[model samples]
Structures are given as structure tokens and as C-alpha cells.
Target: MGKCSIKEAYVRIENGQVYVCNMNITPYEKGNIFNKDPLRPKRLLLHKSEINKLAAQTAQQGYTVVPLQVYLNGSLIKMEIGLARGKKLYDKRQDIAKKDQRREAEKEFKVRNLY
Candidate 1:
């Protein structure tokens, strides 16, 4: 799955169907503005069979479904969904430490390259 920014998007489930809700795709500046509304959110439908299977698994394990990334593949838009469980305080601290370590490593690499 690719990483991308989704400032205003959410996952929605209705009648056992999964959807990417409130996803805003900006209209082309030179395109016909009157024909499209930029403020309107585009609802993306996910594969029903796959989503159903994942939902069943996550439900049985007491995990929640969360959208991790949103991106476009050619003409189709895709969302990466994940089954997530709530993290404990120590888990959060461990994650933070890992992130910090990675960041520091990157910074050191950049500095070494400059020499």
C-alpha cells in the first residue's frame, strides 16, 4: 500500500458494504468547472467479497477496521484498509521510540552524505 495524505476522508460501512467516504478530488483548473463541484465528496466502493471476509475476521477478533491510505491506480481509486486493535500505553511508547530512532538514523545519514 502507498502512503498519501487524506485530510478529509473516512471509512464507511453500510449493509455489509465498504466505502471510502468524504474523499475530495480536486477538479482540474482548466476543465469544465460548471460540470463538476469540487466541494462534493466522491464515494469509492470497495470489493464486497473481500471486505466481507476481512470484516468477519476483524469482528471475531474484536478489532476495528481502519483506512490507512487512499490513492489512485490509473482510472480507479483504491483505499487500503487495516484491522487495528487499541494499543496499550507501553505499546504507544515503544512505537514512539521506534519512530524517533528511524528519524535520527535518517538525519545522520543525510549529515554523513554532506561530508
Candidate 2:
């Protein structure tokens, strides 16, 4: 219902568990009966082995876990998360240039196939 993005979200790791913080989930407009707080922390359901691995990786290296997508699978809601490292300005520029080059190559291939 409102604006929510990665800029407003972050992850918190504590007590051998992972908690997603600062994420907003807006409720329905028609009725406010079953609505909860929008900015509540949502605990992620991960295995013990996975949690330990994530904890170790973050401790030794400067990596952060970020949620990539939230979607429904069957009747359950699933979340996809990824480990991310901050990129410098130069790194970002290089990535952007590479992406543009790949896009151009794909476009050229499509045109060639059409003819």
C-alpha cells in the first residue's frame, strides 16, 4: 500500500538466529481487523546449520544478508535472501558498463535472428 524498499530494510543476527528488521508490510485497506504492525521484525525460519554458516561468514568477512524477493509458493509465503557485499563507486560503474554491453549484444543477436 505504501513505499517500501531495500533502503528501508536490513537484517539482524542474534542468539544464533536471523531476524529481518525494518521491513514494512502494509495491511489491507478495506478492513483493519487482522492487521499487525507494519514495521515488526520477521524471524526467518532457517536450519541450524545454515544459521551457523551465515553467522560465521558475516563475522569473518564484511557481508550482509539481504532479502531479494518475497513471493507465494503453493499456499505458503516464501522469502529469498542473498549474501551481499558493498561495492565501491568504481565497482558499480564497471558492473553497469558490463550490463549495458551484455544488453547491446543481446539486442544485436535478436535483430540478426529476425532478419
TM-scores of all models? 0.49, 0.67
Model 2 poorest ten-residue lDDT run: 1-10
Pairs of residues at least 3 apart in sequence or in different chains that clash in candidate 2: none
Q: Write the per-residue lDDT of candidate 2 for residues 23-94, one digit (tens) a residue.
A: 887766775677777788989999999999888877766688888877778887677888888888899999
Local error of candidate 2 at 48, Å? 0.5
RMSD of each: 5.6, 5.9
Error of 2 at 23 (Å): 1.7
State the C-alpha lDDT per candidate: 0.68, 0.82
Give the per-residue lDDT of model 1 (tens digit) for 22-81: 555566666674756544544546677876876676666446666787668898767777
Winning candidate number (lDDT)? 2
